[model samples]
Target: MSTDFHGFSSGPDSAGGAPRTVVDWITVAGDQLIATIKQLVADGNVRRVILRDSSGREFLSVPLTASAVVGGITVLAAPVLAAIGVIAAMVAEVTLEVERTDVDGVNESEDGTPPPSSPDPEV
Candidate 1:
């Protein structure tokens, strides 16, 4: 259940939260969907999650409130995750589209590494 990912250029922002938004596409085997989604949830910056089958037909769109699971939200999310798992298991492979925010300037790059900092202008 390996994954291949690519990021798309972020679009205009709406009122609220982090100033920047980024979208990433991850292609993964069906068995790995749950793990991927869980990791994204834990990242604490994802704004949305969309699952699509091999044909590019989207099956699920999950709108998350800035990736944090507060109290009873975790309980509510469990059923959604379970439903995603069941749908994923029926397909061979699927694409996961994620929209993440750069909360407090924390970069959520694909490699799990922060983007390089820029040189100070005064230097």
Candidate 2:
């Protein structure tokens, strides 16, 4: 029998920009992989399944028996966990609020009069 696996990694760079995060990597992987496994089963060439991460760590393994493969709970759970993680992450974080002021808005003149609305017509 033939088996297929895929791995992925997510992280941020050192720059001050936004950080790289895997919001739904696991869920996407699980959904796609399970679909592939189902297709393989239909093709009659797959007998076992194994999923791994970028660190070469095996996250799940299962024999491709008719009943077990059809009723694989791990396959279903992976996406759920990933969804929860992503949702939690998306909801838990708050954005930084910065107040901006226009330099011209400050009344620098002694009289405190706003600058002329328009250039002097004579000038």
Candidate 3:
């Protein structure tokens, strides 16, 4: 089955930026859970990945930091991924409520689009 996606917005964060919290919701089949999560993590922008069942009960929340990615993921994610595999087998469907931030620390507008560039100096 095809997946669905939508964005949820929040205000400025500790980074002192506008719309730093952009959450995207993706619903995927239980069998596709691990693959989807791996893809998202590899993108290197995701701040956290929360998996929930059809009934909206959160099963696991994987918080991924930049360091975790740069430091080698296999060491940190192997166990967690194994657990996710088990969960995927037991559930028929799951919804991924994932948070993606600007990997470069760029700020985004309320609509989840990048902020407009500032005017050049000494025009």
Best by TM-score: 3
Residue range 7-111, candidate 3, lDDT tens digits: 665655636644366677777877888777766766666789899888889999988887866654563467898889999999988888888774335434556
Q: How many residue pairs of model 2 clash at the backbone?
A: 0
* lDDT, candidate 2, 66-111, per-residue tens: 5544655444357644643453344322111111112232212345
Tens digits of per-residue lDDT for model 1 on 1-123? 356666654544333453687677778777777766766676666778899988889999988873244432483367787889788879988888887776444454446533333111122
* Candidate 3 all-Cα RMSD: 9.3
**What TM-score would each prediction reach against the true structure?**
0.70, 0.30, 0.73
Question: Each prediction's Cα RMSD?
Answer: 8.7, 25.1, 9.3
lDDT of 1: 0.66
Which residue pairs in model 2 clash with each other?
none
The models' CA-based lDDT, in order, is 0.66, 0.33, 0.69
Better of 1 and 3 by TM-score: 3
Residue 20 deviation, candidate 1, in Å? 1.3
